[model samples]
Target: MSCCAAGAEAALQMDGIQPVSADELRLASRDLGDGTRQTDLSVPGVHCGACIAAVEKTLSALPGVESARVNLSMKRVAVKWRALDETPPDLIGALDAIGYEAHLFSSATDEKDPELSRLIKALAVAGFSAMNIMLLSVSVWSGADAATRHAFHLISAALALPAVAYSGRIFYLSAWSVLRRGRTNMDVPISIGVSLAVGLSLYETYYNAPHAYFDAATSLLFFLLIGRTLDHVMRERARSAVAGLARLSPAGTTIIAEGGERRYVPIAEIQPGAMMLIAAGDRIPVDGVVVQGASELDCSLVTGESAPLRIGVGAKVQAGLMNLTGPLTIEATTRSENSFLAEMVRMMEAAEGGRARYRRLADRAAALYSPVVHTLALLTLIGWMVLTGDWHNSITIAIAVLIITCPCALGLAVPIVQVVAARRLFERGIMVKDGSALERLAEVDTVLFDKTGTLTLGTPRLINTGEIKPEALAIAAGMAAGSRHPMASAIASSTRRSTLEQRSFDAISEHPGLGIEARSGNDLYRLGRASWALDNGGDEADTDAVSISILAKNGRILARFAFEDSIRPGSLAAVNGLRQLGMSLGIISGDRAPSVEAVASALVVDDFRAGLLPADKVAHIAKAGASGGKVLMVGDGLNDAPALASAYVSMAPATAADIGRNAADFVFLKDNLSAVKEAVDIAHRAKVLIRQNFALAIGYNAIAVPVAVFGYVTPLVAAVAMSLSSVIVVANAMRLRSPQAAPAPADTSAVSGVSLRTAAAKP
Candidate 1:
């Protein structure tokens, strides 16, 4: 909601514009599934809530458009529409008709911000003029004679005219653009006031009057430009997180052709199934699985962890991970546009949208603000004229009213805080899917966590490997290597058999929840549940039991293996922190009751449910929310996706299943559970600051507007007051950037539970 020159440069450059063809528009759009597509356009003229309302209203009314959302921080609009009879909607033409020049948005980080440079240059001119004019005005104010006062006024006029002409175009062009479209904006009143002040000063000087307001006119532009410049700079600072992330993507990658020749391929041209040759020091360009060689990757950008991860053939890797150790060849799984990096950028941009209730209120107020200010200014002029018959004083008072009641502060109240909070969350390795999620998170009083991936790391370790024979462990590892189940991963990592010693399995298959089954030299092998592998005609024993996995050959048990899911780092501190904040904690998990109970007791959470399906988890969340408390769900499995969506506000680990991660409102990239408490702390503080901003804006208006209308405030003073309020609001939102301590742990001595260390112990 900055009153800055957001789109003025685009308006100035809109000469001989042409409509974008439907084919071109279609080429730039993304297929969102279900016959719908999304097209993002960079609209440089959009800076405030009213501009957002105007553009979205115009675009949403088009033939096939389903929705249009404006991200003011990015100065972009995303339009979702269905093709009507194989034709794309005329989005570009519609925007042009409404006075906003637009083109397809490019996520490249190198684009320059023309409006910011223009503001800075214009500010320089206005500042120089204001200083010189103030020096001349001092002689006139110090009781100079008629001839001397007139001479100083003429010199002031010479300095002020060119400065207003140069520095004032930012508002003039913006006002003209909207006015010609039969609409009014915040800039309309500003343009009128500045114009009238300069005009009246020229008229008085011609009549040899004792005073002229050339100083007021030039100084007004200077102060207004200061606010505009600061607003633009602060907003760009807030959007730095997304820009920094975009810079990590390489421009292109080395592609290995079919004939074994390597060639450079641009990232956008790298298609699925293309073989990419990644060097030892290069960043991964797309999501892929390793096909040859091995490497250690610095996955800090993706996972928020500083440690290096080792990957070999068959290991899945995402884009933005730094390959630190050795060269590797990988087959791309998705195009650059659909890669994990692109998705993360989109999510971050979405977090800046004006979807929150507070922003909606601010927009509605701004939409109605311009007309009300016009009426108030006109009434003040008429009142003064009827009272004193002096047209000069009356017009000057009207100009003051216009400059004082600009509503810049009111427009900025909500969005500034949202941008600052989003930036803070991003710095902490948390991605907020929507800005409104922060508002909902602030109201949460109860927190429910999933057992496996949410509270624990979801990676289990084979702790009882000493009890199994080497031959039996090797056979189990061979079968386990083919499955992605947690226990299978544990078995594969714990027993490292050489390629020659590894048993060759003729066939291998996995039974969803049961386990892995394989065949080697006509001998059958099963590495899963005892009941399922032994083919016993009885109920499943693994549902309520501990983590004892059985290895059987030809229906006889060879060795019994056990695993333990390590507690996520900071789980104790996280649980204690949430409790310190007066939150009620519980566990809802799909794990065996014994495992879930062990983790729950260690974390000191009393309310627990285990062995529940996905639907049961959703029902539990729904039931908890029905009791007049907002429930925050934290989980990381495919089974938790439904529950994540059903909760009031949900969070997930970066290692979560794709479905669960997408469903959650917040995604924490770090392995530590401490991010949960950190996000909550930020949300609560943001809510408080937003309230404070609203109060400051309203309080300023309540005191300043009446003084201007009564002629006690001049146009110069009014301009200073308006701009200062905006700066105050921005400065208040910036308080969130200060470092906040992680919530301290609550006392756990009175709670009865298993020891966390023993439960996650490694042999």
Candidate 2:
């Protein structure tokens, strides 16, 4: 996405860095010589340099606190001070008072990002003073009187002091640190710039030798800091989604007991076999069976399908899902850890924390540019000094080098692009959970899809019927109503059988890998395979007329009902679209070959593997991935979890099993195969915008830096150019919203009901 926004798309924008007072500068520094304690605090939400100043300024004013340096991009605060007589909670509270939520970072070697705000602020102040100082000196060029000059010099000195103490402090400290380490960073040139200007200005002010370059030092600081803040803000926006997901789950759940009892019970405290009563609109407490009452539950969280499902007695429900209708009582069958919702949350957390194959472009750039910029700054200083014998002129040239090459634009390049592109993606209902998943998606060349819920109407339907009494259909519906089979359950629902006598048939037995059987009166009822019922071998010729054959008490056929899973409406189109995108598509299904092949043909899949266990799916994905092509696995069943994880990037519809959905890097709420195309297209568009932004930023700097170096550009002019460059980048990225130039991904067909949208649709 472009880093700049056009007129209608403008949002909050960043200004150049403005340094605070010496008192503020002191907040960022401390004398570790006093045997003070040190602590590293991490706040994942810190967005800009202003946040840094807010945290530092508040802590610095505290009685025993020494110094605090807050890294805006890293969201880290480094503090050094004598042990607080106050407790850790008090210290945490202190941080909280400044709008910062902090947690103590436990790592002994916590890495700190070099704060860009410091440079941006320094540049802002330096630019402002540079203009004012130039205006004041112009009058002095015409022979001002003693007091006129004294007053002018005094004003100049006053302006220079804050710049030196606040914005310039980091440069000085960095120079000192690098000096000690036998190396130099970009700060080395900055330190030289400020030191020369202020030192020479002080000499002139004290001894009345024309004028000093105090203005130059301050101007340099301001420009650099502005660029820095823009970079930080963009990155914060990019990560907002994952952070928002983290906040969705509550820290604890409220459980009710007898006599209106209530307490804060941690999620982990929930155990299986507990009778949990949930009120309307409350999150389901844990995975459990509906033991009392009935309610409509919103399983959007579990399936990504945006529909509310009705849950009645004997139905299974899970935690994190909201009860949208009436209150219900549940007999918990699994602990919180085993609940589907918990598994989704766990999956998201793992995906967020797991290391992707590639790092982000911005981080990689920062890593390489830091040392290079510092080296280039050093070279600029030496080159300028060689060309100019006068130290004052050389310092001015060196400061210009530092100001122009601050790495602010370079830092803003990647993050700004990602933020715009990601926000656009969120609006389209495709969530890329892993920040790095987009890069992986761009590289995907092979796609593996799960059959049951992925490519076909995972739900079953009554397709045909033969010689079955209405009463017999009602009885079968009532008996199979509570089953979990994809077929029997749906066929059982083709009638209103709720009023059927609740009979406990004798000899009730469910063959684990097969179907159910029972005895009522003198009738031995069989409800699965035709062969199982007739006590004969399964025949392919007869399989063509596949139907459920219910037997009567006297070996007569009570009824024959045909059930078939419909292919999703757009599944064929989606398969075709992926093929157009140069992806190889195939299917792995747990269902038998006949069912799997039938659905695959509808989708026009080239290859199909049937009766796959979860491990088999994983092995297929793994084998495909081993060929060096990124594999995107789309699935919804529990059996597809491993395949989802092993693929380069995975996606699942909201109705997918919790573990499978969690394992996926992306989740499509609407569940049409079209989302895959839409998401990938969006990612590709984002990459283009990012590249455009990179060019705009690099080109602007290419021209602007030379102007600043040659002294042809004033501080005010530089700020305007920098701001305009930023606006352009953001505007470029926001263009993703226009559908005509960037058309929506095409959907190939609507022949079946594969969209999770259909699943979520009310009956």
Candidate 3:
């Protein structure tokens, strides 16, 4: 069966699926019965506020549904209703009552109505016509003969009618909507102004009057359309993360039958309990438990983690994690629909497409401001006629005022900044998940850091060892070699430096929180806790991870390994810069207290936490957030998820785990916390640029609106000045396109896991 068919069956089997909170399941009246009949709805021709309100209001009036909400953002309706024995056809009939078609917006088809495409095309025509009309209007301003001026006036009106009715349809629809709502917004004045300008301009052309301003109205529509289209494009581009999830598995899987024969099959076709074999470096074909062998899996590619994890028999794996070890046979425990990984992918998709709370002050204003400008233009014409007694001159000045104040520059301010900020971040290997992150970053005042994986390198090294040497590590290394864990690999790597001919170690053992042990020769070897090694008695003062002792030919704790991982280059400078800028810093981690304190002390950070779980980290972050300062939390572990979410704006390393990245507001690549500090500084500067741009744009209008209204300025001249002012404001905002950060000081401490090579390169 197709995915659509499968989804339908699941809906049938379960209670019901409601896309939103209240939907086709509840009725307006208490008399409505169980409305569980599957409501398959597909809305083909829905647009404008009326269509949204009409569909929602009508569908909710159906016998079963009590309430309904239409997500105009998605063009989908959700219903609440009673459980019924009927099929979805009953709900379909009810939506038809509203004089519209309603069917499920099926996921199967790639078809989309050309409504937006048509809008763009119309907008382009209006814009092109407006520009040509503007050129002709300029001739009228340059002392042309009355006949020539009149000819251009008629030409301008000829181009404007189609522009207003087609390209500016939203202006009319929105104005009508507000009136129906018994409310008023910015669009009211704009629509009123445009209506008055066009009406009077056409009258002037027909009556052979001298003051038609058709060019002015068309210019306003053109610029507004440009701003609107740019905003739409920005939003569409920001939603690529959703598209990322959609393109995740190739829509298929490999299945093993009950008879144990394997065959490639569609991911949707796999059933629970089917065994499947996955090769090294291949994605697990299904979410399942390892029934056959062991391997190290790198789920981090999808999860945004750099480290690989070991999985053995009884271990569970997801479909996207790449297997890095030997082959493993997995038994499917849940069908693809019920898999945990699948649920994660679905949730991420849903979140990306919904409820981001993306609002810019400019957008909110534009959405309402257009109508207000229209109304003002109408009122202005009436005032001029009443005051001046020259109807032709009064109407021309009103057209100039409308053209000069379309709010296009005002609308473009925030969106342009949003796009530029996102683009700058992308250039520097950062992905800001959504607009809210940037908004919060602009106001952040404090930063909370995760000590282990964020500020300090997550990789631990043997910083300095005492007397234990190569022979002492034989059993330890041999046993660890058999294991696939990170610590095992670390120890094995260190042991490989010894050129000693190795012997097979037997009876290898591991104690989860303690350590591991194995036997290589007659001389016994001990490699674990101080107590465990010292029972046979050896020195135990060293705190190194690879510390050891021996029961050998010459028994001694000889040559303990001295290992060190350095801090990332420029780390100190970044921290110092943030502090100098008056932000407080704190660190939290799940590592041992000594380990946490060691790095914290090196950096001179006053506050730090060790051994915190995900919830504990969140609590700490909430505590910081509630303290009346904007806070930035940074971490790259699963344990950091909640804390990251709770902060004003949190950053994650590119290597962060899936949950970490998901919870974080910003993601930093190159795994340098210094970049976090730099980004914050950039955000502060961008906010400043935004303020300057707004002041400039608003200032231009404040000066020009009155001049245009007083008839000291012609419509053509006003259009030129207004368009120039907007361009200047945009240019001022573009100043934030560059970043400025002092190069960070190199870290010299080898306690952290950063490389010394970068530190040495520092001037």
Candidate 4:
């Protein structure tokens, strides 16, 4: 095998095993530097908020397990414990005891998810059997003689026995696994209902009874399978974001060997201090500093800013960013496993786990559903036996109760709405990461914004280009163009019209953290920091003005170029729309007070905090929450990550740092800030629809449960009613998908002035 292929195989093999001992697990785990060891385990059975809660609770309750968090989006559980006290085998055993089958997690196994295909096959079998058995049942119901009914029932038994046994294994296996561990989930009751229906139908067929319930058992499986299939498909779709991100890093990179020879090597094989060459359009393979060459890198993935950042010698470049303009030689500072991209993945997973702690409305109902359903079924059996003294009839009625109160509608309620709402938001360039984010967003009464990238075009623009003479500008641009720095690029771009082919300098040099200078005809022309270029380190008095860079020829100051972080298009309108919605808007930033206030004034935001650290931002959010304010934080920086997690609901630009985006509940793709407003509006509409769905589910149960208990519903009627309730709930959720119901598109004009070229570079 090729070296890269072998390296890939090694990585997969390391994570592919089911760790048999604590020592084996330690090999796959990381020391978090705080006496805690963390490992990720693939728990494919996690499907809903309840599953998240169950898995976390079960593992967390174990001795030596400090914390166990499950990321529903990834279907992975991250467990942390002291290495001295616990082992991987102990935790795996705990998960198994709680009915969750887990294995060491690896990205290589993501494509091998079998649940969707399994559910689809089960659904098809159940659907085909249900239709065939129903046809047989219709003849028996139409006043057929005893022998005819018996023969039809016999045929249905022959068909449904195998079909239910095969198609119903999805529920049966889960129910049986949990029961063996002496625990119960929603599937346990469902398994009991299916088995009882099939068993009773078989008994009636044996005795040649007048009526049989072959149709009910088969039909129930078909409907339940349909729900499971839809749920699985939606969850699969939700996982695409993380999958897409994982594909951003290059499979291999060209690294300089010990003898200065270049060879293509897998990212896993590159170590710290290794030198790698990256050409234009290649994603960086590791976090490193540029040692040679210069380039404009698309750093949207790291800073959440769509602007391409110019980098040269001494500039740091992170993995996952594209080398947009030129080739670069870099010295790797970290291995691929500990690069910025990998850290982002870890941060996202951790943030998602924290968000998963929010319980959905359906889960709350489910907690009450299982005990209520079992009690009602028990009472029905006892009451029927006491009144009629017929054990067979009583057991039949009790089975009816269990099958009737299957919670099909309750199960469909939130997921259907979430699926619809998520689709709608996706169409609007908004991605909802968690199921409960919409609910939390609907409660946000206050909105907080980060200054630099969140509400403005993060690229600095030369606003004072018109003030300098064309010839002087030409000299400065020529000197600045030699270095791929942000300020240098701004100066070069602003002076593009001042180009003079005849004015070539002899040599250009850049001073680290200072300025650039070029030698022309025995005189030095400089473009850089005002003090460094002018040879005077005096503070400028005009604090509110944009930043200035000095231009000098042979120690004589020629001009100063001013730069500003331009406001994003539609920022004003987005802020206005949020205010019009009665949400209080404010700004919190780590920038200088003057810079923050300048932007805040232009946006008409009066409530603002400047020069705040990450902890300070979190403190502000906590104080707001204490005052009963539901804050919606919108930011796009590593520093904003903590504040994002602290808010009631949070959003980040797609260009945002991986940590920031992962911390946010919602991520908007477009450059427009109007997405923030649209997300909130959709959230409000979704909340209404969700409540309506719950009412429909509850109203159906309130009326149907009593009738089933009173013996007014047969097994067949109960099955039909359950299917109808589910259908009704799903149909109501579909309303969110309507075009007319969508929030009006944000004004495109709001995104003007910031050239598309700078804003279009996706991470």
Candidate 5:
């Protein structure tokens, strides 16, 4: 029977599938902050580039949908849509109409993969049957008598029938699913080839012919299943980072009630301001502040730091951190859905845009592959029939042509390499927000860095505190207490042990890119840049030593306060590594010229710009790109967000402001500057592998197809060839995980005049 006829007899019952209510969908969706809502759905049937294009195109045409994207590696679809009269889009129904079954996305990891289990079972049956049939065929090949050979052929037929029925269903069902919806995928040709081979073997067996192909039919199923199983396993390994993060969150936490009673509640029920008691060995359940106790925390998983962090009252802790030393009571600051762990998982699973260059070409090729293979097989059959005048021989060769030309290798080329590269970066504490960013990073020719908070630690310290009078220090510290700037923080912290009386200001305000101004009972006090604090022009030329902020009272300088920020660990190494790779490096900052120049000279970078506002940074990045240079911007501050978004590619540290982190293409958790060079190196290697994979895939078809068309290969040989091609591509991608693939740069442990601490204390 035809596959469609068989499917009709076992069609899915609509009532068995529960529909998600609109209210439930609304609650699950996230607001995109642009009058649109984004909903994610899991479609297990999506496995290739064609499926990605089809699903995205179908959903994007819906009434309220502004955009739709499919993540092939995750088998999920994200749709952004505007609400119409407060109604949610019917995403599940639209997918069902196109012969796909979808449901609301859940972060819960499945204990077992049903598809992988089924593939393994199918492989076992096919392998057992193939060995047994090959044994029977050997006896026939040795010239057994007519009656014995006939009986053996009948027995082989019996064994092959059950094996094909059980093992071949994997391909048959997938082929039928897409065929019924007026589409074709790689599986269509596979199903046709296997069925024809089996049918011809059965016919020759019943007629007592001299030759039969029962061994060929069973061996084909065995090899195809092997390839499918390995592909599934490798893909799973590439995406394990996201799954590992999901497993870190606890199901419930002990919430302390207002009346001093404690009860275990689900993570979702813990709200903002709720007091939760965390045990000494439990993972933190939410992003919150430690309100009552002191303890050491194991923050390796969250921040990629191996050392335990010491926390006390008012210290902020993020979710996924492990409490190691003492029990603590903390007030929750954000819901579990908005926690840091959840955000990382979301970023890792984000889909690449449909317009990415290589992805687009691959989709087009997959879409056109099925029809081209079908046409070639049809023409081969007609030409062979005319040349040989034997229908059996012609049909067999055509089946060989179909099986040999399968595009499995082409389909796995780009995505598998991308997944492997993403996993590699994830292991080093770097998160890639988009897969295509790696492709772009490989093309960068210039690297631009922000000065404060980026090249330097941005946490300045008071170096001239002992040189100034005690009363002057007291006044500066009191005025600095209200500001959060790194300079102000330094002053306040340095005077923690002073015995002077507290000084209060009637009014104080901080100006961006400048300093702080205060009014103290008709005595004007300024604590900031010299030019802005004093009216004598401040002799700007004399303020070239370090970062200097003047304390002026009534237009007279009371004290000169000098500060210095620690150079970030590995800055010298990162600069040298990038320079060795032949990239042009520069510094762009809002700091004074002296500070920027000092850092630039230390790193040996010649192109430097300072005293620029946020807009100026953006304009510089734009002009660089416009001049034909692909720029990689590295920054960490609220003011750096726009520049990060404007650059060709950007990276930010984990301590960067929320907006800046969100705008960056990559975020590194550790404080080391080496991550920038590491990312660039890995990207270059990944690009090389992707190109090699494409070549191997195209080159395989170029050689194998003609041999099958001319009757030089059999169905069994075609299966083995196709399977090996895919395995070769996968094995090449696996090389990325090897130690020799991406080697570490030379060690700089003894580099002079730089702090080697990888983690800094929170300010």
Candidate 6:
């Protein structure tokens, strides 16, 4: 029967099952801005690419539906549609027509992981039954008499029958559903093979025949269930990165009530303009401005940077940051749902959805596999019947062919490797946001780096402290302490003054983008741009340094405090390592030419561009790609966000700006730049393992399929061969867990204890 006819018949048969209504689906969906509504639904039957194609095609054909994306690893489909014209019931009906059953996905609905637990239980039952059935079959094969052999076969059948019914339902239900809709999947062949083996064995036993396949049918389920369980476990591990991020925000926050009393309230109850108390060692619950107190925040979750940022009054603190020092009183600037952390989670989900569009190796093979396997099996059966005129023998060989060519190894080939590689990267403080990141990372031939936050520590430090007198430095620091600009902060930190010295300066006022000014007795002091402080009359110092802030009193220069962003530790080693791997390196920076040159020269990078905007950085990446280069862009600022998303592959530090981290494919923790090299090396090795897995899967089918077609292999032997092939593929993938260190650089002198300073000096 055609799929449409079968689907209509199945719909008739499903009279007892209640269909989900439009109102119900609407309630489940969340508005995704711009008139789009999206909802995630659990799709249990989606095992391979064919399922993905079918589900997407069916739902996307609905009116007002914009897109339907399936994360096969998660067994969840995210559908987006125009809210004004479409409803959830419409999409659900389309899925039903296509043989898939979906329900609104809720993580809190189940306490334990229901899917994993089910797989484990089914595997246990299959394993136990297979062992007992095989033992009985061993007795029957030991040359027992007719009556004794029949008794042994009956005993084996009793154990195998229930086991198959219970454990094999996972495949049988999926196959039946698809077949009822007039389509086929990997489960179709699997269900057919298992049913035939068990049915034929039951008939042969009842008729007192010489052979029965009770052991073969049960053993196939045992091994196949093992593969299914492992696949589930790997997917769960891959999903932990997002889950870990979600756990960083507290569910409730301590709010400072109107009467000065503190009360704990759920995150939802905390609104914009609400004041909250964030104590040390607690995660900030909302995006807010610090109204009181001082502390350092561990902002790695937001920026991907390892260093803690010092926050004082008026400083903005985002949700998901851990307060590391004193308590802070903050007024919430945004609701919990719209906080920066929530935005990061949304970006990650969207990026992962995009990544899922990349077809897996297994799925690509399956698209070509289903038709060929069915045709070959059918041809083998017909050929045998024509040659020998024996229907029974022909059907037996055909069943063996189908059973042996089950795609078990092919289905497992890519996902297993990805899971293993992700786990290894996770251990090294790197989180891979998508499965395709490793593949894309492996192909990158050029590395593009941003100067600030990417190569440098991103924190400016005073470089000309020795050039100023102690009294001048103290006055500058006191004035600098009144402002929060990067240069001012550097000067303030470099010059520590006693409370008495700070008290000497009064009436300090900050000039935004220029500098800070203060009055001490009769002298008016200013520390900022030379033009602003000295009115351009001061003698100009000729230098190539990128940033220079001047300090003056009464229009006379006192001292010039030059600031430079220090290079991160291991940057030279990382650059050298990439060079050793034959990767072309370059830098694109918004900083002035001198500072950019200083960093590029320090790392021995020759290709460099300075003073580029975000769009220009993107154009630079595009130009490299146009020249046949696969670029890996590493950056950590709001300006770098666009370029990060545009690159072939991207990495960001944990301390990167929210948008930059969101756009990046991988986020590495730690202050050392060596993580970049480590990520690349791991990706290369992972690709190697993925290729080996493909080879093993294909090679197994090459040798085993012919033997089954020739009728030289029984169902029992075919089952063993199929199981062995999947095991081999998984074993090869496990090799990715071993350490894959980048080659050490030949020279460590520049990388070790090197201080980077701009060439220009201020007089």
Best by lDDT: 1
Q: Could you list the CA RMSD of all candidates, in the order they appear?
A: 2.8, 10.8, 9.6, 7.2, 4.3, 4.7
- Candidate 5 vs. true structure, TM-score: 0.90
- 281-348 per-residue lDDT for model 5 (tens digits): 99988889999998999988766678999887767898889999999999999889888887788777
Task: Tell me which of candidates 1 and 2 scores higher on TM-score.
Answer: 1
Better of 1 and 5 by TM-score: 1
Error of 4 at 562 (Å): 2.2
Sort every candidate by TM-score, greatest first: 1, 5, 6, 4, 2, 3
Q: What is the TM-score of each candidate against the true structure?
A: 0.95, 0.71, 0.66, 0.80, 0.90, 0.87
lDDT (Cα atoms) of all candidates against the true structure: 0.85, 0.59, 0.59, 0.74, 0.81, 0.77
Look at candidate 1 and give me any clashing residue pairs: 7-44, 7-45
Kindly indicate the candidate among 3 and 5 with the higher lDDT: 5
lDDT of 4 by residue, 1-763 (tens): 0000011122233335354676778877877777788888887666555566678888888777798877655678888877543444377777766667677888652476566677778889888989999998889889889888888999999889888988877777666655676766676677788888888888888899887787888888887777666555655564554565667878889998889899999988898999999999999988899999999998767555678888778777888999999999999998877786776555444433443222355666665666888999999999999999998788778877887786667755665566566657766667676657787888889999998788876776777777877787777777776566667877776755444532479998888767887898889887766566765653444424556677888777888777766677668778888899999999999877887777777778999998899999999999999999999999999999999999998999876877898688888767778788778887788778878877887898899889989888887777777777777776687777523332333434333443222111000
Worst 10 residues of 4 by lDDT: 1-10
Q: Model 3 over residues 40-83: C-alpha lDDT tens digits?
A: 24453343233444566677666756556543323345455654
Model 3: lowest-lDDT 10 consecutive positions:
1-10
Clashes of 6: 9
Residues 724-755, candidate 6: write the lDDT tens digits.
Answer: 88778777877886455544444334543444
